[model samples]
Target: MTKDFTPPVRLDIDHLQSLYRSGGLTPRQLLDRLDDYQAAFTDRNLWIHYLTPDEREPFLQTLEGESPDSLPLYGVPFAIKDNIHLRGIPTTVANRHVRIVPDASAFVVEQLLAAGAIPVGKTNLDQFATGLNGTRSDFGPCGNAFDPDWISGGSSAGSAVAVALGMVSFALGTDTAGSGRVPAALNHIVGLKPTLGRLSVEGVVPACQTLDCVSIFARTAAQADRVLTLADRRNPTDAWQEHQQPPKRLMGQSFRFGVPAADQLGLVEYPEAQALFDATVAHLEALGGTAVDIDLTPFSEAAALLYDGPWVSERQLAINDLVNTPDQVHPVVRDVLSAGDQFTAGDAFSARYRLAALKRRTDAVLATLDTILTPTCPAPYTIADMMADPVALNARLGAFTNFMNLLDYSAVSVPAGFLDNGMPWGVTLFGPAWSDSTLNGLAGRLHHRVTDTVGATSDPLPDEQPPQPLRTLQVAVCGAHLAGYPLNHQLTDRGAVLVKRTRTAPRYRFYALAGGPPYRPGLIRTEDRGAAIEVEVWRMPEDRFGSFVAGIPHPLGIGQLELEDGTWCTGFICEPCGMDGATDISDTGGWRRYMASMATTETRQ
Candidate 1:
């Protein structure tokens, strides 16, 4: 082993790949250096089980003839939260009594392995994944990557610290309440809690089986997007898997985002936190986002339901046998699980009904905005402070995060800034399910604007290529569907936004179709005599295009129309049969002008 083996400054996927291509390092050399680093920090209790050299030999051997160009995660290293399974490794949920070795790796772990990512070890977590603070672990509490005195946040504690301290390129963690997000904010990294059921949970321990989601921790949001794209595969054996859906709403350059009303912020007590959140909102506005104040009553009520309501029963059911013998479990975890016993079936039903009603109201708020911005936690707590008041402090850490999975929203938590004490603070950008890619893209841009360094590393963030715009279909509207027209609501109601106002190619003739209460216009392609009719192009979500097309009446239908810019788009076109009784309005140049002419003629009569 090279005694002075200095690993890459940043363990992000891109930097590692560049180093490998330049022959500056090999996977074996880096792993050896990482082994040395892990040994140096053995007191942090970051890992429950670190793989030995012989145990990791097979993964290194598989990369012998493979090139980084051939694989997305080629030769990259990652950590797995202890609750997730790795073939033949002890699956400890921070509890020795319930540990078991799985015969097969998790569905997500297999996908990462196939893409050439090596797993170094399983990291520690809160016992049975119950608390939001890292202190309840049977393996000793994991500490903040920057300062051991502060709490590392919960359940996914070691996983976030690993990435923050540059132990691995990325790590896999699970988020039920706020396990995945809180840790990232405390440690200064990016944590992406995907839409519920977006990633398979097979071979993993369940916290809340129905609401559990696999999350990714990385130095940057771009890296998280890459990992999510690879791990998001359907698993036949996983009954809770949900397929990714096309976006229902579209976000543009200038978009509206929601912020909790002042009284609901939960940051007034901590002035530093409040100031940091204010700065975050201002930064987003600089990036062309408009802020809207929204009521957090429903969202806050739903968050309270996770722990205070009968949902605690799901935690008890996850490890019933172990809870029966409370001596084996951590005292805090045991107490939390025991609370499940008092709730009866009727209470569970009542909570479920209340949750449904809250979801409806939350959904209505989400419909009016592109995303919501909130501080990941109202404030950070010291490890000593957290341990002294574990339950309440843990609950406070989850204020902005606990409502995500319950409301079926996707969230990306990125470092916003650091507090005076040097501990990192972050903000979460969240939206409805299926908005994962958009949220990630926005998060990436915001992250680059705020900080150059990730975690405790001095290396600057890699320059990311501009993300491809969201998939949308553009349609040219000439009449009733144009902006401010009587039928314009039909377009806006389906999440369509105006792209620009331009003229159709000069090769089309404009017509005022013979119609009733609300008239319409059509454009017919003509060879010799035609005018450049003005049209407003609107971009609509692809998933909504089919329904929008289905609503078109007989005379005008969706067909290709050429624009003045020499581009073709789906637009309104007229069938030859419907033009028999139509008035030739080509001389008027557009529908709006023709309407003005008709009004003039009526006044003269």
Candidate 2:
């Protein structure tokens, strides 16, 4: 070996990507260094199965022709929670009694691999993903990355540790409630939970199918953002998959953020977490977020529904035959799932109804704010403390998290500050559905403001880079290309942003295009028969405009259209021949409104 061939110890996506491009590192070299890193942290209990050279060769083979610039995750190594399948790997869900070797990767894992990411192993979890504390596993606990005596928050424990320990650039964990966030908080890493169904959960062993979200843990928010981008690609096979596009509402220069009213924060017993949260509020304000105190009663009630209410029955549905033999499960985990058998179908409906009411109330309150900030975990506990009273410790860890999936929101947990004892503390930025990117940007800007270290490592924080706006043309859109709509991601993924919203001039006709999966609309200029319609103007990169135009298929074409204010620009236009037998939708005035009416009409039919 060359004497000065230093390894790329900073395993961030951007850093490693740069090293790869500069010829400073190679995939083989990275694997060798990871071996040294794992050897140093010998007792962390972070893996259910770390891949051997033979096991990883197939993955490396897939990356032969990939380029990092094209596939941003090319050559990057990642780990998955045991509950999620990776083809040819055994998914045990942290239990030896239950082993399932899958022939297919989960939808998200397949997407990651296709984008050039390599899987190194599967990480340990709470048995069946049932506990927030890591100790319920037969493989033993995954201790805190900072302090071995402290608990490594679970049920995604080892996934977080693998990232914090620099074993991988990122790791995947399933978050039903707080499993994703708590572990990141304890490990001083970024935990990102997208909106429900945002990432396809197909092939993931669900704890609660309706609430499960495939989450990501990374050394920085930027890295997590990249993984989220890749994992959130459109999935056609997963029934739960939703086309969750980014929100368009801009926070502007000054944004409104909420916090639990003085007495509403549930951290009275954990003074350190409480202090850190208070400081976090101030930090948000410094970042141009106006902090407001709001009542957390409705949110707290919704959180209780996850475990205290009949939603426990969903756990019973997840593990088919495993529940038949409760002895095979951990005692506390079995105790929790046993309650599922006691709930009647009527109980499930009642709990759901109550949750709906709370969601309505939460929405009404949150309409006045951009996001709500809170401690990622209200209290940090030792492994002994969690084991002494399993159920209660888990609840405390989930205090600020369980309500998120229930309420259909998105969140990012980032390192806030360290506790006096040198353990890391963190806070979560949360908002309504489709706001994953918003919370991501805010969490990162806040992390840069508050911390200077990554995980338990002595390495310094990477240099912060300001976001650079793309050079784009201000193209007007009136249909599917609008933000949060079905096809909006095409614009967003290409660096487009919705800049202006307005109505078109009364010289165009709207028609519902024939044929569907992704239904679309077409507009045409007519001499006399026309109506002014709603439209959204987006700024798209000139370089991307050609590719965007190329994907317009046949019926729709790019052409000039007049806006309400007497301006003309290229927009959606339909070929007259393709309009045969198409339904006229000018009455609805816009594509979104037209689609809403079609849905309502279908429901009635």
* Model 2, span 57-117: residue lDDT tens: 9888877766678887888989999999988888888888887889899999999998888
Tell me, by TM-score, which candidate is best.
1
Query: TM-score, each model?
Result: 0.82, 0.77
**For residues 1-605, what per-residue lDDT tens digits would candidate 1 score against the true structure?**
00122334458788899988999989998998888776765656889989998989989999899989987898899999999999988998999777689999999999999999999999989998888878898889898887777788888989998888788999999999989999999888899998898899998899888889999998888889889889988898899998667666666567899998766886854678888888889989998899999998899999999988888898888877444576887988878778898999999999989999999999999998999998888888888998898888888888988888988999999999888777788999999897776788788888988898877666677777533324567888999998888999988998887767999889998888886668988889987887899999887778888998899899779999899989998899989988878988999999899989999999999
Model 2 spans with C-alpha error above 4 angstroms: 1-8, 464-605
Alpha-carbon lDDT, every model:
0.86, 0.82
Cα TM-score of candidate 1: 0.82
